[model samples]
Target: MDLELRHLRMICAIAEAGSVSKAASALGLAQPALTTQLQRIERAVGGALFLRDSRGTRATPLGDLVLARARLVLPAVDGLQDEVTALVGADRIGQYRIGATNGPVAAGLVQRLSATRPASPVTVHATWSADEICARVLAERLDYALVGACDPSLPAGADGLVWQPVCVDPVWVLVGERHPLAGRAEAALAEFAGEQWASAPGDGCFTACFATACARAGFTPRPPLEMDVGGCIDLVAAGNAVVLCQGTVRAMPGVVPVALTGSPLRWRHLLGWRPGGPAAAAAGELHGLAVQAYLDVVAQRPRYADWLGTNPGFGAQPVTAAAVSRR
Candidate 1:
């Protein structure tokens, strides 16, 4: 049997999903059919590609070799399709369907696009997690996503996507302005073990990451009050509870963002989209818009801004006062 583009894409999906069943569901195929197809592909390739385990499917040595080539081939095919589609028709090229986790950049991107391309329609969606946003983008529900990743590593299933690193946003501790630690330069994560945290309700991966980070600091954050980031700020401001927030967050009344002594918390901001798509084609413009927005935020908070500047190359892109403006 001649292995085709569909076969290659399926292999990549399986590798990323880490399970045949999950990959099959994502591809809208039955698990048994996917299993049979996987077997055939293995036979054609002359070796087993993945090893099944209780943990999940992991790529074998042969599988890794195959995937490396598949990544290159898949994007080349996508580029060809994008070019051809653009040449024949431009109807779907202008509209931007974008999503983002809670951040200032998403609003900035939408506003900037509206100001620049007044005729082009921009749709923005909000999800609690980047993984879900990435899934929607892969499904073509979103043209691109501004995602946050605390781990700094790309999640699985991003084989053919273009990811541009924007910055590393430090996660700050939010407390009432009247709180004891509010006036301090920094505090330790363990010091807040007894305090209640206000968090947004969601099954997003951030919940797990947050829990793990707190666990490492010697305690799990107590049961948090369910609320959006804005609501979290309100609660924190009223001296009701504390919450974690991004460093670039604006100055909310009655609340103050204090850094942790070790500064152990951070999340990488990334722009993710399919290669050769409209979003990928406009990656530089998107990055510049995000950088400008971030710089504006940094300027307002001198403390974190100084910390950000000193930690150059630590994931936050270097931007000068001049670079913040268009050339």
Candidate 2:
């Protein structure tokens, strides 16, 4: 429908906040201004869009479909604006749909990507699992996907693909301050094998990498209490369990990170995108910048350079503050 930009934003806001008044408050828009826009949108569609009730506004079955489309399309329209601006040299802009299994990678990449092209638009969405991200890239649903240091599972009927090694980040054990192992600089896996485990299981690499590290230490880890990064921190900090995460995980509140002893678990990031596609080159550019951002965050530590070293002659592009605006 030929709706105004406010109509789209109104729908998206309503969907997110679950109420028109809440959306209006969040947008700093008066309730009637938003109500009029919603009415216009619904009229254009020939029926009511939201099911208004005592609690708030909920999407009708039709409204839910429209809301979902608005979520995907409005950002895509912004992306189109970027691409057009870039073509005229008025901007360095493009739309990127990246699939990843965790938050830090998405957060850091957004920082660098926005820094690279401040005028360009970038949207990051989280996939519930790494396997889902991997498959999304292959199916062309995503422009690129970042896989964790992965197990060597092969594709059954793969033809053309480009897998660029991305970042190699140090994996650490997250523990409570009162825990016995926390005071030690490092502890062998066997030393903490019996501890209850908590982890983010969305990334196959993280799960396997940690579990394998535990197994190589000579015992199977009990089933983890799967949690998000915050819950993991809260659980571990309460002295209920031990968890593993990369360096940035230390940035969370209420959690202290400790180095692992014996053999350290090194996670190598893989940049997966379709080979020979137009995005392949862009994906490479993204990987280098992303790795640099991770390095910049952890430069004091030297051991986590494995994947950065994997790219031979990786200087395909020079990253600079000025270059961020140039794309």
Which segments of candidate 2 are over 4 A away from where they belong?
A: 1-93, 151-160, 203-209, 299-327
RMSD, every candidate, angstroms: 11.5, 14.0
Best model per TM-score: 1
| Model 1, span 1-327: residue lDDT tens | 456666688899999999999998786555654776688689889999999988999999999999999999999988886676556445667888888887657787777878888897889888764555776677566788787766465533344567776787778888999998999878888889889899864323455667778999999788777767788888898999999888777786899988876667777677778766677677677777777766666777787778777666543564333221100
For candidate 1, the TM-score is: 0.66
Predicted model with the maximum lDDT: 1
Measured against the true structure, the TM-scores of the candidates, in listed sequence, are 0.66, 0.58
What is the clash count for each candidate, in the order shown?
A: 0, 1
Measured with C-alpha atoms, the lDDT of residue 5 in candidate 1 is 65
lDDT (Cα, 0-100) at 148 in candidate 1: 72
How many pairs in model 1 have backbone atoms within 3 A of each other, for residues 3 or more apart or on separate chains, i.e. clashes? 0
Model 2 C-alpha lDDT versus the unseen true structure: 0.62
